[model samples]
Target: MRFFNTEGPVRPTDHYSLPPLERWDLNEILTFIEQKKYFLLHAPRQTGKTTCLLALMDHLNRTGLYRACYANIEGAQAAREDVERGMAIICSVLARSAQHYLQDSRLNNWVRADGALVPAGDRLFQLLEYWAAADARPAVLLLDEVDALVGDTLISLLRQVRAGYTQRPNGFPQTLILCGVRDLRDYRIHGSSERDPITGGSAFNIKAKSLRLDDFSAAEVRTLLLRHTAETGQVFTSEALDRVWDLTQGQPWLVNTLAYRACFELPEGRDRTRPITLALIDQAKEALILERVTHLDQLAYKLREPRVRHVIEPMLAGTALGDVPDDDIQYLLDLGLLRQGNGGLTIANPIYREVLPRTLAFTPQASLPQIYPTWLNADGSLNPTALLEAFLAFWRQHGEPLLRSAPYHEIAPHLVLMAFLHRVVNGGGTLEREYAIGMGRMDLCLRYGAVTLGMELKVWRDGAPDPLTEGLIQLDGYLAGLGLSSGWLVIFDRRADQPPMAERTASSTTVSPHGRSIELVRA
Candidate 1:
């Protein structure tokens, strides 16, 4: 039976999937190919660009309108700056693809006969020229993972494509599509010599348009889940379906992974008589995050990149963007880590918002010093007073030293605190975070059994006024949202003039303007 596919391209016969061509503007794509245009198709990793391109290739070839072929040049990335080796691999892959997809063997013969005669920079151009000439039908070439080529190799490929721009239909492929994780214009090609860095737009100036493949829509997400019901007679409750949409925001791989885990991997869910519920979906999400599966793991690995950090750090700390470059913001958007909407820029979806901070706190969480479970009562529920006391004691002894271990210095205190809280929630509770650009504070809610603890974290930096009043107000609002009467407002004073951790850290009881009880913690 077909199942949700998390790895590689989705085949309809083997996987539950949407129609590929329906994901984009098919009429516009057809027009571009008919006009012999060179363009780009880009999206974040695992968003189905390759799947769509392959389907498009099939559609074109089936029409008998063009000799279409799809080739992935990712195998050449290992050559790095070695243009000759990279180009050779690309040409060979293309030749094999032509044979497999079009029943055309002339490209293979041409590569054997003329491969060495052409210069490294002109090899791709020559191969396409020969293939287009050998066939009466115009050629449509789909080059997947085009950005995987590095440095001078990438430069050479783009320039070669640009070099062959004018000779289409007969002398070169009538339509060439470059597909990658980012738009070609975002590439910064650096050579091995003293020459300056080159922009991809300068190298591939002939590109007529660039299109991005979006995540599935909410309706599509529902349709996919219902397909399983149609086939297996096991249904997803309305709330379960809504939960899936909320968590995944229609990210293709995430949707498939969650559904697969809930319906197939979990023993309780394996019974075809059982219906999927929201709790099961939440359990799957928690398991997915804990496993750090390949997609989420790769995303976590990208947090260390300077450009990514430049945009992410401030967002995590709930501070103003503070002069971040537009390119850095755009890069995050292109990566599908952030989205812009009427609510403004936020992490793309709820799952990503949860993942980023947890990923950052991972090291600190693993290395936390020994502390007794004083917060756990004999009955197994959490004790708020004991939890606070335990945190204060932990902070007094090891907070300063542990702060140094945080991944981002600007948000060190936040990560260190989260590391401690993660220990409290460990196996039986949930820690939820809500922070965003211009929010000026990070709000957290810890739910353990029947008890809920709301919190608001504010950083009191130099040149900024005391955040106590603002934080209390924010905490009051947050507590109301959680239907709680009291919570904690933590203010981390980061001013250079402040005393050391042990001397300055303290807590006191207060009241919000709305009469809710507040535990004011200043550290």
Candidate 2:
């Protein structure tokens, strides 16, 4: 029976998957190859780039039109800047893959070259030339993980590919496709032989086009899960399928992992007669996040990068991403950390949206003082008034020490607030967050039993007027959206001359333009 695949490439007989060619514009790719053009294909890691290349290679070779071969040259990354060692491994892998996939032994001729010595940089160029010459059909080379190679080794490979671009059809590979997590334009080749940092464009100026393999669409997500149902005689409830799309937004790996965990890992879920439910889907996602699954954990680690911080920090603060370069934005998008939304760039998926805030709130959450959840009523229901009083007292007692420990200076107050709330809602409730560039605030909606608390957090920066009026307007709109008659508006005084937390932190009730009562908290 077919099962959902969470690791490695998906095989049709074992895992449910969308047709590889259906995920891309095949006609556009074929036209590029037919015109003897070199191009790039890039996407987030594990989003099916390798699968597409393998399928494309098969299609081309089976058509009797081109001698196509797919190779993963990541084995060369271990050599780092050692150009000679890296290039040798890369060329050897290519030859082996060509023999395995195309059943072509001509890679032997390229590597051996009649015992003639080929220089490190020219190694790949010469190999391709020899392979094209020996093969009866035109050569098509698909090199996966091209960005994994770094330093002079990466430069050499790119230069070698560009070095042989003039030769076409029978002289060199008719089509060379570079596949990696980043577009060729984003490759900033450092430690080059030229003694200066160069870009992949300068190294391989012959690229004809670049294609990004996107995640499965909503419809495709349905088609994929239904295939498993068709094979195993199990069923996914309508809500379960929708929940998958909502949480993962059709991310290929995440979609598969959630389903696999729900159907295979959970004891109750294994019963084929029992339909998969949205609750099961949520449980699966929670498990994946809590375990720090390899894919999500790797993506989370990207937060520590300075380039990533430049993009994410501002988004977290609800401020403009000023001075962040376009390339950096594109790089984050390629990493699946960001996506193009109706307004502008946003976190890619609901899971990622949850991951960012929770991750930022991690340290504060752990170091929080042991205080019982004071917001619960006698009936174990959430009391927003009690929660506000408890937070005010906590801020007066522990805010200074906690703020000193926060990693980000700009968002320290926000982090501390969220960490406190996360502890309260860690069980028996849900906390939803929304922040964006130029929003000037972060909105949090805490849904506990029989109560939903909406709060808007704002910072009063140096030389700026009190944000009370502006915050009120923003909070009014926020409460309107939540369909609530009351919420909290928190204004953090960030001026260098501000008073101590004990003196500055206080709360008062106020009326909004929409006639909603708001608890205005200034700290």
Candidate 3:
């Protein structure tokens, strides 16, 4: 039976899939190809880019309007700065892909050309000229993972393609598509002769436009999930389906992975009579994250990059991001970590919302000592008073040391607290985080069965004033959203003159204008 595909390009006959062409602007793409334009098709990895390009190639070929072939040249990424070797591998891959897709072997014949030699830089250009001349139909070349080729090799490839642009459809490809995680404008190539990085547009100069393959829409997400129901008579509850969209926000890989896990991996999920529930969906979501699956693992690893850190640090800390570069923002977008939101940037999806904090807090959580689950009552209910006391005790003893060991300097205290809470709340509850730029404080809502305890985290920097007033106001608003009467407001004084943590840590209770009692904690 067909299943959800996460490993590679989705095959409609083998995997449940939405029509690939529906994900983007097909008319604009066709217009570019008809005009013989060299362009870029880019989006985050595993967002079904290769699948759509393959669909496009098949569409063009069936219409007999162009001879199209899709080639993944990422295999040459291993060649790195070796332009000659990289070009040779790319040419070979292109030839094989042409033969496999279009039954064309002329590229192989022209590779050697009776022992006649072309310059290393001109090899790709010469092969393209020979291939185009051999076919009466205009050839459309789709190069996947074009960004994987780095340094001088990437430069040489782009330069070679541009050099033969004027002769396209006769001596070169009629239309060329460079497909990768980043748009051509964002390419920062460090070629051997360059003292500094150069933009990809400078290297190619022939690109006409860049098109991004968008994630599936809400309706599309439902359609993909309903495939399991249609095939096996196993139903997904309305809430379960809604939760899928809510968690993934239509990221294709994530949507498919969750459905695949629920339907095929879990024994209860496989029983046709059992309807998938929202709880089950939530379980699958966390399992996917905790397993450190390939897609999520790759994304989390990007956090170590200095460029990625700058934007994410302020985001986690709820402070303003000052003087961040435009290129770094675009790079994060290209990496699929951040998406353009209503007015600014946001973590792309709810799954990412959970993934980022847990990833940052992973180490501190693991290093935690064997402390009792002191907050759990005999009836398994959460004792809020005890939980807060435990947190205070833990903070007094280990918080400072953990903060010193944190990877992100700007958000160290926040991470340590989150790590402590996550380790304490495992197996019986869920932790949800809400923070954003200029919010001045991070709000966390911990749901343990019937208990929903909210906490507000604020940092008082060296020159900043005490945050009690602003934090209480924000806490009241946050409580209103949660339909709660009270919560905790934590202010970490970072001023240089502050006494040692041992001397200053304290907690008290305060009343808001709305008559909600807030437990105020100062550390």
Whose lDDT is greatest here? Answer: 1
Q: Could you tell me which residue pairs clash in candidate 1?
A: none
- The residue-by-residue lDDT of candidate 3 on 312-338, one tens digit each, is 999988888899888788889988888
Provide the lowest-lDDT 10-residue window in model 3. 192-201
Best by TM-score: 1
Looking at model 1, which ten-residue stretch has the lowest summed lDDT? Answer: 192-201
Residue 145 of model 3: what lDDT? 95
Give the Cα lDDT of each candidate. Answer: 0.90, 0.87, 0.87
lDDT of 1 at 358: 95
Model 3 regions lying over 4 Å from their true place: 112-116, 191-195, 198-201
Write one digit per residue (lDDT tens) for candidate 2, span 187-242. 56866342256554456678887899999999999999898789878899999999
Model 2 TM = 0.93
Q: List the candidate 1 regions with Cα displacement exceeding 4 Å.
A: 186-188, 191-196, 199-201
Error of 2 at 368 (Å): 2.5
Ranking by lDDT: 1, 2, 3
Error of 2 at 323 (Å): 2.1
Model 3 residue 207 lDDT? 86
